[model samples]
Target chain A: EADIYQTPRYLVIGTGKKITLECSQTMGHDKMYWYQQDPGMELHLIHYSYGVNSTEKGDLSSESTVSRIRTEHFPLTLESARPSHTSQYLCASSPPGGANYGYTFGSGTRLTVV
Target chain B: AQTVTQSQPEMSVQEAETVTLSCTYDTSENNYYLFWYKQPPSRQMILVIRQEAYKQQNATENRFSVNFQKAAKSFSLKISDSQLGDTAMYFCAFMPLNNNDMRFGAGTRLTVKP
Candidate 1:
C-alpha cells in the first residue's frame, strides 16, 4: 500500500477561518508536492519541497503556504480560507532520479470554504 | 514549459472489453517521464503505469499497458479486460528530468460498465 497519508479527508469551514491540511510519508522520499484539483478537472501543482527547509511555488499560484521541517511531513496552511480555496488537495512523494521514477500520492483533503 | 493533453473527457467500455485513453504532451527535454494515474470516488490517486522517454518498448503492468510514440509525443493507456472496479478518472502526467514538478492533463473519466 502507498505510505503517503493526508488528514481530514474532508473539511468544511467558513470563509476567513484558518485551516491546515496535513500530509505525511513514511517512505523517506526527498521530493514532496502539493496539487489542487476541482471536481472532474485537471490537477494543478501548487507547492513542492525538495527537502527540509526547502519549498517552492508551483505553476499555479495558491493562497496557501507549505512547510517541510521533516522529510516525512509536509503541511499546507491557508491563513484565511475563502470559498475560492474549496478544492481537493493532494500530496505526493517520489524517490530520487532514476529510470523507474514514480510518485506515491495521498488520499487527499477535500476542503470546502463555505 | 511542458504540457500534457487528454482530449477525451470521458469514455465507456463494457466489462471484459478493452478501452484506450489518449494522451499527448509537448516538451523540449529529451529525457523525461510519462505516467498514468487513476482516481476513484475515494479521491486517492493511484499510479497505473509509467514510461520513460528513452525506452522504445512500451511499458506494461499486467492488464495495463501504454503505447508510447516518442516522435509523436503521444502516450496512450490501454486497459484490457476492463472491470467494473476500473471506473475512475485517469490523468496523464509529464515530468522532466531536470525538474521535480509533474504536469498533468485535464484527465479522462473511464467507466467500465457491467
Candidate 2:
C-alpha cells in the first residue's frame, strides 16, 4: 500500500465555503503533487511542490492554493468553493531517484460543493 | 508541454482473460518517464507500472506490463489473467525529467466480468 494519506475521504459543503484537503506522506519523498479529477474523467494537475517552501501551479487553472511547510505534508486550500470545484483531489509523492519506484498515491478526497 | 491520451474510454474482459489498454503521449524531451495508474471505485489512484523513455525494454510488474514504443509515442498497458479486483479506471501519465508535472490521460475504465 502507498504511504500517502488524505484526510476527510468525502466532503459536502455549501458554496463559497472555505475548505482544505490534507495530504501527508511517510516515505520522505521530496516531490508531492495535487491533482483534481472528476468522476470517470481526466486528472488535471492543479498544484505541486518539489520541496519545502516550494510550490508551483500546474497546467490546469485552479482556484485553490497549496502549502508545503514540511517535507511530509502538502495541503490544498480553496478560498471559496463552488460547484465547479467539486471533484476528487488526489495526492502523490515520489522519491528523487535511485529506487526508480513509481509514485505513491493517497486514497483521495472527494469534495462536493452543494 | 506533455500530453497523454487513452483512446479507449471503456473496456471489458472476462475473468482469467487478458486485456490491453492503449495510451499515447506527446513530448519533446528525450528523457522522461511514463506511468500507468489505476483508480478503482474507491477513487484511489494506484500506480500499476512505469517505463523510462530512454529504456528500450518494457516494464512489467507481476500481472501488469507495458508496451513502450518510443518511436510510435505509444505506451500501452496489458493485464494478464484479469480479475474482478482489476476493475477500475486506468490513466496514463508522463513526466519530463526537466520538470515535475506529470501529465495524465483521460483514463480507460476496465471491467472484469466473472
Candidate 3:
C-alpha cells in the first residue's frame, strides 16, 4: 500500500474561510505534487515540490498556495475559499528522478465551499 | 508543453467482458513515460500500468494491458474480463523524461456492470 496520507477526507466550509489541505508521505520521496479534480473530470496540476523548501506552480493556474517545509510534508492553503475553489484535491509522491515510475496518490480531500 | 487527451468521457462494460479506453498525447520530447491510473469512487488514484517511450514492448498487469504506439503517440488500455471492482475513472498521463511533473488528460469514467 502507498504510504502517503491526506487528512480530512471531506471538508465543508463557508465562503471566504481559510482552509488548508494536509498531505504527508512516509516513503521519503523527494518529489510531491498537488492536483485539483472535479466529479467525473480530469485532474489539473496546481503545485509541486522537488524537495524540502522547494515549490513550483503547475501548468494549470490556481489560486491556492502550497508549502514544503519538510521533505515528507506538503500542504496546500486557500486563503479565502470560494465556491470556485470547491473541488477534490489530490496529493501524490514519487521516487526521485524516476520519470518512468508512477506516483502513489493520497485518497484526496473533497472540499465543499458553501 | 506535453498534453494528454482522453476523448471518451464515459464507457461501460458488462461483467466478464472486455473494454478498451483510448488516450493520445502530444509532446516534443522523444523519450518519455506514459501511464494509466484508476480512481475509484473512494477517490484513490491507483496506478494501473505504465509504458516507456523507448520500449517497444507494451506493458501489462494481471487483467490490465496497454497498447502503446510511440510513433502515433497513442496509448490505450484494455481490460480483460472486466469486473465490478473495475468501475472507476481512468486517466491517462504523460511525463517527459526531463520534467518532474506529469500531465494528465480528462479522465474517462468506466462503469463495469454486473
Candidate 4:
C-alpha cells in the first residue's frame, strides 16, 4: 500500500544526545510535513518541505532541524536532545494541489528523553 | 494564521452507538479545508474525514462523516456504529486551500467501549 513511514517507532534517549527521526514516503508526494505532539495533545508544525532541497521552519519554533535531500525522504534532526524534546514526531505528505485532499500520515516516532 | 479548537477533552461511546466530536476554527481566509485525524494506540495517524470549505455537502467515509458548517467555522466528526477499534485520539485540523500549512487542535480522547 502507498504510505508514509517513520522509523524508530519509539525512542528513549538521554539528554545532550543527538538523534534523527527518519521519514519516507512512497507516494511520491511533493509536499511533506513534520509535526510534534505530546500525548493526548495538539500537534505543532515543526518543519515542512515543498520538494527536493527545499525546507522551511514551521510556526512552532522547533530546536530541531530538517533536510529534504531526496523526494521520498525528509528527516528531522536534533543536535542536542532535552527533556522538552520528548514528544511524538509525526510525518505526513499530501498531494500537490493542497490540503483539500486529506493527508497521509506515518506511524510516528515517539521520543522519550530521560 | 489559522487555529483549530476541540472543546471536549474526553468522550466515551458504547459499541454500535453514534458519537459526535466538535471542532471549530478561526480563519480570515474565505477558502480552506477541514479534517479529522485519528491516532490509534499504535500511534498511526490516519485521516478519518475531510471537508472542503466551498463544498456545502458534508463528507463521509464508511462509518465516519463530517458536519461542515462554513458560516460558523465549525466542522465536526460523526462516527456511527462505533467499535472498540474506534477508540483513539481525535484531532481537528484546518488548512487553507492550495496551501500546505495545516493547523491542528488539541486532541480529544475518544473511547469506544464494548
**Which scores better on lDDT, 2 or 4?**
4
Instruction: Estimate the Cα RMSD of every predicted model relative to the unseen true structure.
Output: 1.3, 1.6, 1.2, 1.3
Question: For residues A39-87, could you state the per-residue lDDT of candidate 1 as single tens digits?
Answer: 6677998999988999999889998999999999999999999999999
What digit string (tens of lDDT, one per residue) describes model 4 on residues B1-114? Answer: 688999999999999999999999999999888889888787678888888788898999999999898889889899999999999999999988767788899999999998
Pairs of residues at least 3 apart in sequence or in different chains that clash in candidate 4: none
**Tens-digit lDDT track of model 3 for A52-96:** 899999877999999998999999999999999989899999887
lDDT by residue for model 4 (A3-110), tens? 888998999999999999999999889999999988656898889999999999998899999999999999999999999998989999987875567789999899
Off by over 4 Å in 2: A98-100
**For residue A31, what is the lDDT in candidate 1?**
88
Model 4 lDDT, full chain set: 0.90
Regions more than 4 Å wrong, model 1: A98-100
The 10-residue segment of model 4 chain A with minimum total lDDT is A94-103
Native contact share for candidate 1 = 0.69
> Which whole-number lDDT from 0 to 100 does residue A106 have in model 1?
97
lDDT string, candidate 2, A47-110, tens digits: 9888999999987899899999999999999999999988889998888872245678899998
Q: How much is the lDDT of residue B51 in candidate 3?
A: 90
Q: Counting only residues 3 or more apart in sequence or on different chains, how many pairs clash (N, Cα, C under 3 Å) in candidate 4?
A: 0
Better of 2 and 4 by DockQ: 4
Q: What C-alpha lDDT does candidate 1 achieve relative to the native structure?
A: 0.91
Better of 1 and 2 by TM-score: 1
Pairs with backbone N, CA or C atoms under 3 Å apart (clashes), candidate 1: none
> Candidate 3, which CAPRI tier?
medium
